[model samples]
Target: MTKSDTITWIRLSAVRLPLPVPVSDAKVLTGRQRPMTEVALLFADIATAEGHRGIGLTYSKRAGGPGQFAHARELAPALLGEDPSDIGRIWTKLVWAGASVGRSGLATQAVAAYDIALWDLKARRAGLPLAKLLGAHRDSVRCYNTSGGFLHAPVGELVENASAAVARGIGGVKIKVGHPDPREDLRRLTAVRERLGDGVPLMVDANQQWDRPTARRMGRALEEFGLVWIEEPLDAYDAAGHAELAAALDTPVATGEMLASVAEHRELMRLGAADVLQPDAPRIGGITPFLQLAALADLDHLQLAPHFAMEIHLHLAAAYPAEPWVEHFDWLEPLFEERLSIEDGRMLVPGRPGLGITLSEQAHAWTTEVFEAGVAP
Candidate 1:
């Protein structure tokens, strides 16, 4: 690649969007009716001298927008004049540069923005879609709907949501559990199971609401429902507890969404903490480390189901040798110009160069702040 392909300028911005419907899980059961909002996104756009630009983003539930933007600003100088395709070198450099502060949380989230943009840039430069660029194992992957089944909704509403998702061709559905009364959780699960029947896959997320004993007791009780997996039955860092719960229950234990590094995931695997691994690209330092973690999961023969951001995870999931599940979330749909295509529970991977989507006019309008660095072309 020519010098024109080198990074010339970097732009960072924060976008705050109000959720059309506030979502509450078991962890936030008290705030059920309140209309919660999310900062939604912190975006990065890397412009190369060749004039091609790649866009990337990380998200926050309701905060961390300012911190992510500030970290990106601090990291941008290290990337200016560097080759956009040198993703590994750049990722390492950024990680070490911010090591004094920490390698996880906001810092890694910031690194994700740049690293994702670089992969997008590289894929676009090659004129291949990200999945194809990464050597896709398949062009489409199965999906499950998780947006509708929140703890705040009535039991009838939960059943309706899962039914509607199945009618729309989604193969699976998940609902929030972890109420103070385990019987209440069981009641909701029973209703959903009756509605969806035995054919449709059902899963539940506890959202780390239990200790080891509770997790073990509840996991065994819920086994009768034939759940696809029990997600976050305990705190994400509780490796020994997770392993114990996994061994004691018939249901597969799944976690890793909140984790921040490959080393953390390595520890989880080493401890046999989970039967299924759910890594998020942005949270684990973007696509580079995600690939590393996926490889590790493959060697261990664990199931792969990445956390959120289906638009990005769809491509990564398709790269997995075994069939993987991508989560369907419409929360960020307003920020993008194109919507993903789904049929019969599988989403089609975009074949266009890079991630194959552009930020919408609404995304620009929602921008709360912007930061820029590097020389103009």
Candidate 2:
């Protein structure tokens, strides 16, 4: 293809809409009510000579609301006329140029969509699978099922979910703990392990609900369950707390879901605060930054179990040696063109170029209002 055949203008637009997804027992560790909101993004290569297009999403029930639409609009002007082939340079420009507001959260997620689209477009141009382009790896990737279907479930119900996961061939499972009462949490852990038997690798996430003392107490009890790790036991911002917990606990203290910068992760590693790191692909800019973060984790002897977005995380984990958990949640299936393939408890890395997915026709219809509105940020 000639220079004229390449992408000439990138269009970044988004939609803020609610999906009709059922809550499958996922509850806030604090037992607080969940914020009801969902956000998704659509990026177009208006100038693509090959008719290549890609879509991405950033679903949040937290602080960043429909306000992400504003960030997406702000970035469109900057990327509208850039070459899709210049993915690395463009990604750097997007993240660094908006340091004041775009270094984290929705701003970073918006940039991530476009950056990931560029990679998809680039991969399409080269006729290569994303994993192959990223690194040489086995085509199939491992996965751990995170059946968050237990927000209000009794301890028995949670263990039932674990048994169901194992029955379906998954080898690992993640459970949410950190209820206000430490003893009750231990009771739940005991029931889950007893039901799942001794062989399954069980991981627990506190979702940043506990403080140092509470985390230490919970970690001590969890040690008996042989937990893979304890995730976000304390605040995500507390590096010293994590280091303290690591020192006090036998189960590895895991975090990094809320970290938005490479420097932040580097500091966490230097402090020896964690044994496993879980970064979200869309949350921390995009794959480019994720790879840099993964490299940092590898060098520091830390494991990279990314926070959900397992479809995307599968690619990253396949590229690296860190034993990762490809969080198995079905919330996005309503919007994806190709669903992730998991068998025998592992997620297979897609061989398609550029994130290997497109927006489902139904999802595009649902999101039409947000994109067509062209709402000002």
Candidate 3:
């Protein structure tokens, strides 16, 4: 049999990539202190019998490292001797295999790594970039900066960060809201708007800190600033609350970053929970289900602005029929050798095959543990 016809082996590693500058956000769901020092990245590499290799990765913010890694180990043996190109079948198989303890969270994240690796292999075989392989809708997509606008930073520092991004030609900027005092949130947003001027698009993420009443009140109060959208103003599962908030406010409501599956996104859309969808590729079971979520959002007339990991989202956003926005967060740059190009407020889609990323030597040095899984006899 040809080497490319069957899967040979899978390699997984858990790397502790430290943040250059610790980040803090207002909505502390984990009951932890501000400024998390690092994040755990679970990396997967799949090798074909034909000598082709593809890479995939998923991450956890604080805990769950062992769970995600174990899930990868558990699912790796299922792909032995299977056709790598049969992504749909492989994905379904993995989902059901782990159905007892899967379908969301760590299990789906493990599935994402495998699904993404399959797509990378498929794209490489086709000699086409993933975006083109998926059918390109545009050559580039608009982007906004989110890395610089954290909740713990001083207002002046936030202004400076936004200014730097704007000067670099980023079309928009977003800041964290949901401070304990509503007036503090207002003060920060007002300062940023004044610094950025009226024409530049601005956004705020509450990180699901407020109740429906608070979201309504704050959304109405901030309407005068002319935001691009208000993100995660209520809990992710509070579909009814989100819909009511969207109805009451002029600012478009956006969420779904924390959702683990397309079914959750469907519920959000069916309830009119948001006008914009912010699906994350890894969080939604890789590009396979991400495309599913994107199509659903498009059919429902919702705008697309995928949540972080710009390397993957850039391609996905470029393929969206509507001009979708990609969030910019550079904390993960240390893990990759190559970076995306931004020109005149838009991110250019890479022409490289697959996801167009390579793990850096730094990442290798930072890895804490590694695991290998082989095909079943």
Against the true structure, candidate 2 reaches a TM-score of: 0.88
Model 1 Cα lDDT, one tens digit per residue, 1-377: 53445888999988998776666787776433343556568888999888878888887776677888888888899998887878999999999999998998889989999989888888898999899999999999988888888887889999998999899888799999998788899999999998888988888999888888888889889988888999999989998999988888889999999899999999999999999999999998899999999999999999999998987898899999989999887787888998888888898998788998899999999998988998654
- Residue 182, model 3: Cα distance from true site in angstroms: 1.2
For candidate 1, the per-residue lDDT at 93 reads: 97
| lDDT of the candidates, in the order given | 0.88, 0.70, 0.88
lDDT of candidate 2 over 1-377, digit per residue (tens): 66533454555445444635433222354445463445454443334544655444554554454566567666666665466677778888877767787487767876777766666666666777677778845676656676543445677678787888788776688877766677777788778788777888888877788878777777887788888888888878899999989988889888898887677787789899989888887778787788888888888877778777765677778777755666776666766789777777777777677578767776657664344222221
Runs in model 2 deviating more than 4 A are 1-6, 9-47, 368-377
RMSD of each: 1.8, 3.5, 2.1
For residue 147, model 2's alpha carbon misses the true position, in angstroms, by 3.4
**Candidate 2 displacement at residue 254 in angstroms:** 0.9
Q: Model 3, 105-176: lDDT tens per residue? A: 788888888888888888888888889999989989999999998887899899999999999989899999
Give the poorly placed runs of model 1, Cα more than 4 Å off: 1-4, 30-36
- TM-score of each prediction: 0.96, 0.88, 0.96
Look at candidate 1 and tell me the lDDT of residue 173.
96
